[model samples]
Target: MKNIKLTIEYDGRRYLGWQRLGSSDKTIQGKIESVLFQMTGEKIEIIGSGRTDAGTHARGQVANFKTESELSPLEMLNFLNRYLPNDIVIKDVTEMSERFHARYNASGKQYSYYVWNDVIPTAFYRHHSFYVPQELNLEKMEKAAEKLLGTHDFIGFSALKKTKKSTVRKIEEIRIEKNGAMLHFTFIGNGFLHKMIRILTGTLLEIGMGKLDINIIDEVLANKIRQDAGETVPAAGLFLDEVFYE
Candidate 1:
């Protein structure tokens, strides 16, 4: 058997999420598994680097699966693309070392949230970006974002449920860039918790709108309470930008 790694990109508007939840739910993993099962007539499990919430999209999501098929990388890519739905595309496929697990081996991940700031929402960006009518103070947003860098317990930004692991994570970078009516916030972190990015985005939006004091970021981080944070933004604006591995 060989371990095959796939680099996938998808528009998550039509899918439940990345993972398969139920027999009836249409998901990225479910669609890929269905295609693999049809092509090989074998039950195969694909492991994703991470999960994206419903309506979230991805540009460089990585996944891996084990198979005994002797097909070459290009051939497998073509075969999977032919069977997979149009929303999900297998951008590349390659054979990897047997011990390379997609999730565990990932070094870090990058996510970006897009916002359309204009008087009227654009029909073309309806599904891709969050439309906000109020003008955002980018300077204030950047100031608040800087505080989020480095290692910290992100309990306030995460789901209010206990997990087996620690909520402490290191954010390597946070960048805010705007062009025209498009505003993008990119975050690179060692790892993330459920809805962490969206919550962070919402909090920053509050700062931008002058609803929340930029200095309140310190209190939110110190409080470590879910309610202390801002609202969780819609998943439509979030995208799994990239996954990195060594």
Candidate 2:
């Protein structure tokens, strides 16, 4: 058997997130797995580094699968791209050790969120970014983001009401930048909870809009209350920027 690794990129507008749902074929995993079945003549399952929410895009998503086929990496890559939809691309394919697992071996990940901070709606970015009409206090938002670094119980920021696993997560970096009318937020961390980035962005946005104070970060961390956090931002603006294995 050969352990095959794949680097993938996809426009997630139409898919039902990254997981394979037996009830629906409109999923990134299902789409790729189907092609793998056709090529290998077996039901091959690909493991992704993480799941991307519906309408959330990915620039450097990674996945791996085990196969008994004799196809080389280039042939597998070419065949996958030829059959998979145009919105989904297999950027690279390579052989890996049998012990390599996409999700378990991942060390860290980078996510980016985009916001159009202008009154004029952008036809081009309408599907790509979230729109906020009010002028945001970039300084205040940056200050709030700084407070979110380090390890903390992010229970309040996650969509999950409860989980057996610990909510504590370490956020290594939070960068907020502006270019033209667009505001960009980049988050790098060991990993993130479900919708944690969206919730974190929503909290910072509230701080930017003067609805929430900078110290609200402290309150959320101490209380661990989900309702006290900011809105779970739209999925359109979120992207899995990259997945790091080393």
Question: What TM-score, over all chains together, does every model reach?
Answer: 0.98, 0.98
What overall lDDT goes with each candidate model? 0.92, 0.94
- Give the range of the ten consecutive residues with the poorest summed lDDT in model 2: 119-128
Model 1, runs deviating above 4 Å: none
In candidate 2, position 136 carries an lDDT of 94
Model 1: colliding residue pairs: none
Candidate that scores best on TM-score: 2
Model 2 spans > 4 angstroms off: none
lDDT tens readout by residue for model 1, 1-246: 999999999999998899998795589999999999987788999999999888999999999999989889999999999989889999999999999999999999999999999998889988988988898899999999999999998988987587778899999999999989999999999999899999999999989998989877898789887887788988999999899997
